[model samples]
Target: MSIFEYAPAPESRDIVDIKPSYGLFVNGEWTDGKGEAFKTINPATEETLAEVACATDADVDAAVAAARAAYDKVWGPMPGRERAKYLYRIARIIQERGRELAVLESLDNGKPIRESRDVDIPLVAAHFFYYAGWADKLGYAGLGPNPRPLGVAGQVIPWNFPLLMLAWKIAPALACGNTVVLKPAETTPLTALLFAEICRQADLPPGVVNILTGAGETGAALVNHPDVNKVAFTGSTEVGRRIAESVAGTRKKLTLELGGKAANIVFDDAAIDQAVEGVVNGIFFNQGHVCCAGSRLLLQESVAEDFLARLRRRMGTLRVGDPLDKNTDVGAINSAEQLERIRALSEIGEAEGGERYTAPCELPERGFWFAPTIFTGVSQSHRIAREEIFGPVLSVLTFRTPEEAVAKANNTPYGLSAGVWTEKGSRILWMADRLRAGVVWANTFNKFDPTSPFGGYKESGYGREGGRHGLEAYLDV
Candidate 1:
């Protein structure tokens, strides 16, 4: 053990006052759900955070009916500038209460405070800000002279980045003059509920945004609701597939942002030091719970040994512990079930003869935790390399040439995102051209901007979110 140990510097939990219980936000008020309530716990300490109401089928219907009514009576008839003002107010309120939201998000979602504060919350505000400006500019967006809003958008967001995903789904829908009935993930509903409060603070019209909290059943109810004219989802590929099938043959406009096993390719001629950082960010950022996380690393064989040595050294310096700590790097796994899934896949990797290397960090004993892990001898056939682990695990494979790198990178069924690190601009452009991913990072990895449109191709799901393209999802083009 090292003699110089850093003391814990935890952020004050008093910054956020979590309520004992939360209710569904429907038609501008908190109301009891038709189903039993569920408890959400902090995955970092296994501490119960709050009890949240779970929406039942009737609750979903009521929420949808509210949204449809708002769309037809208030939101739909309102001028675009008025709608823009509400969105701008919401964005400003998000910025004002950012610290509270960030801390609450870390507690509820078990992500590092660094991420919740700097990345998630800020981006949440930015998404609203970005789309807020577009509220009145739909005509010049190249869609048509007059692009009309679709009625009542039903949005289902996953738990990985709860508030951010909600912003991604809700911002564009509202900007296009559509009302929203959003169902947040069961495990991470607090932030969305808090966002409901933000909606209230903005004086957003009643029923413009309704938040439903529940498991998959509630999401199904919202998605299949007859009054909903649009559906947007961000979650596992399996769920996305099911949603696609369920909404098939219907006239509902749909956009699904699904799973990814993205590739971060490093060439021998690249800046190895910068590339190493990019690789770490690609796989381990957010505890590798990102939908477009670069879980697969493709390295040129010539520099594999050197790169691995540097990567291992850097991984050793990561701090894994309480999410509220200001200095913590990696945080707890989102839940026990997710941790078990990660462990099972990692065991499969070891059994298949892949060499496993985990970051040397002490995890808290109380809650769900998994160390940062990497499989060096991974092959294309290995289950860890093929499936979406959705945890802090990386599967490394080597390639001899650029062609082979692209081949291995594009081999997977997912094509949500990809990254390439090289000094040669021509090679970067060449690689980007051939890669089928929706977002390709040339030198950086996992950098997101609200101005950039994000989504996937192939089995990774279809349609785009963010930028002007996001408007098309909720508008009659």
Candidate 2:
């Protein structure tokens, strides 16, 4: 029976309270961790969900050694068909436990339950299902006769989409016959640990995958470990650069999916209502914690006033509440630290002579929350317009012509994604050709499919995370 079918009944609570501690998964079993310990908070309520083991340098060494052994002994020579079966099993398990996973994700990560349930969990399973099909088909992937695994992979995921990112890393790595030592962000370790249980339930081989939890130090130890043959990182551009510098001259293969400051361009001829909805969804999804959020809004001079008026009215209708609430649209900020970062940046925007407008909404006193903020009259030179403000913050700028729109959109060092809203198909193609972003959405925003290759260009980072392109990241050239 599916776990969702038998999911525990919801109980009334003044506040949601989760357990106190969790163990690390090593050698396919949950075990006591070596380093100091830390606590993960419910960002919505500031309640401690659990204490997580802060992985030490020694712990990273042990995890790496185990992964190396698993590669040589179990996963390395495992036939592609066999690996595919295991991935299929994982997909099944995730679906069976989908609701539980979604609830846990919302509780730990502060994203709305609707997003965790409808988007993250489903796509995570789809990723595994898609990659599973590629396992035995490697011979047909155009990679010349024989392709082999990259050995032990060291993966580090960010806090923004913890479990989904975990799926992205582990699914492709395993499908390609590589063992992994994955370090989940310290604040969002719950779902990853739960995934460890799913692996055990599927009877995956020992050390085929391991989950380690900690802050930056643990991730650094894992990435820099000598035994790891490949390193995959998804986080900030600043940290991505550090990883690139750290691995310089080393033989370790690296693939990074970093930060973005995406542009959502609204033309004068757009379907106004639909465009407004897309704009809201693009920037406010996951509280704008997404790496590819449409943080910069480029409004055509002809429709600037009308678009902003509709956008502000639409923002007012959004429901903000507990992440676990099934009906919630916007949830709490992920952490106190991130909330402070957003506040600081917003203040910088105001001090730099940009106008700030916030939607009028009541916020919970105890939780870390930031009202959805929009800054107009923003110059491209303003810090708010240039930086990747990974929060529910948008900066609006006016463009007199299509040329001006393209110039303003391409002005950033980051080139992750952009949105083009117009009824004319020709304009979309033209704008898409001109915009220097990884993904271009014509009439929509934030649409994803496992078959679609997704990644960024320039300092937003390199390497795709989905489809056949993702396979290249795990293969030895």
Candidate 3:
């Protein structure tokens, strides 16, 4: 039996039990927005999760005012040890309510429950724990002498990894004593709402970490708010470009963990079986809904055919179904629009004379879903090779030499991350140095660490998140 067949369906009302119709959390209170209310939907089921209040410009002003006020009067003046305690409490609460948070994450964001439970939630807690340790250790970091907090931070995160992204934004900002007003993606707001409650439970000061749920307008409002001292965003290259332009002359510190077209290089010396597994994890994890997904596969021409066969077989075994199922590997696409994007790109690949193949997997009727897809005979010039599809699709291209592999890998404008699968330590180090990406994984892909700084280069965006480096985003050095 498949994993979905044995796994029980999630109750529809579980999110309601946690929280419903979440509003703007400002000044230590949950208040309704001045604008219209927008309904958030479960990407897995196409069902309404809650009617989240949309934050208008006025709402952004209110949030910033509250945050600034708190920064001066409360959060900024609070001792680092006290900040650490609150972060520790929030981390512990997240660990205790992990299962609930996991289910909500999968239901709303269309990520597999296994990833939510084992990967996202755990990392979310660890991010807090790691930053908590750094709360009072700012002097130890090489940020000159006495780096001060940058007042209020405005953060906008993508729909891909809702709570984890929230944690990535909030943890460091709070650790550095910067009040924050964050805008969670409109599609997945439940986890952020739940996070707001966790902050409340941790007794985090009001206006310290406010969550506003809405679409583009709300995010723009937050970014343009005069009092916002720093702007951090995680999303598409297009949006990242706009943000780069928006914050061009401003003194606001900026960090963008944007989109990627990371190359997963499989060398002739690599363990074929292990390389296949690494490739599967690289692109297919989270339904390929990741900024740093290894969407491009650079196989050594010597082992290309064998590696392709092995990878195809491995993909055939992936059970793509309900994300809540423990046994499922790939889950539903985040939304119908995203599914359309994948389909359109696949069609273009076919039209461009590339061979498109999809794994034989049963899909749910209600939600937007796509099978694991791959395009062979893909050249560097093809749209599939160049663009960020942001779906369960891979573009296979072969390279003869290590130099050729590195050239192909860095061909794209994005430099968020890359993967190197090789047995030789020297070759791995050599490739890692050549790859322009900020994060390079040897025999692995998509690994995160709170102590590790993560970001991109060139068009992929600027600055870094995570580790002691993340504090720089919220500090006036």
| lDDT comparing candidate 2 with the true structure | 0.90
Model 2, residue 351: C-alpha shift (Å): 1.3
What tens-digit string does per-residue lDDT give for candidate 3 at 297-392? 999999999989888888878988888777788988998898999999999999998998899877888889899999999999999999999999
Top-lDDT structure, candidate number? 1
Model 1 Cα shift for residue 21 (angstroms): 0.7
Q: Rate the local accuracy (lDDT) of all candidates.
A: 0.93, 0.90, 0.89
Off by over 4 Å in 3: 1-20
RMSD of 3: 1.8
> Candidate 1, residues 437-464: lDDT per residue as tens digits?
9999999999988999999998899999
Candidate 1 TM-score, C-alpha based: 0.99
Clashes of 3: 1
lDDT string for model 2 (73-110, tens) is 98999999999999999999999988888888888899
RMSD of 1: 1.1
Instruction: Kindly indicate the candidate among 1 and 3 with the higher TM-score.
Output: 1
The candidate maximizing TM-score is 1
Model 1 C-alpha lDDT versus the unseen true structure? 0.93
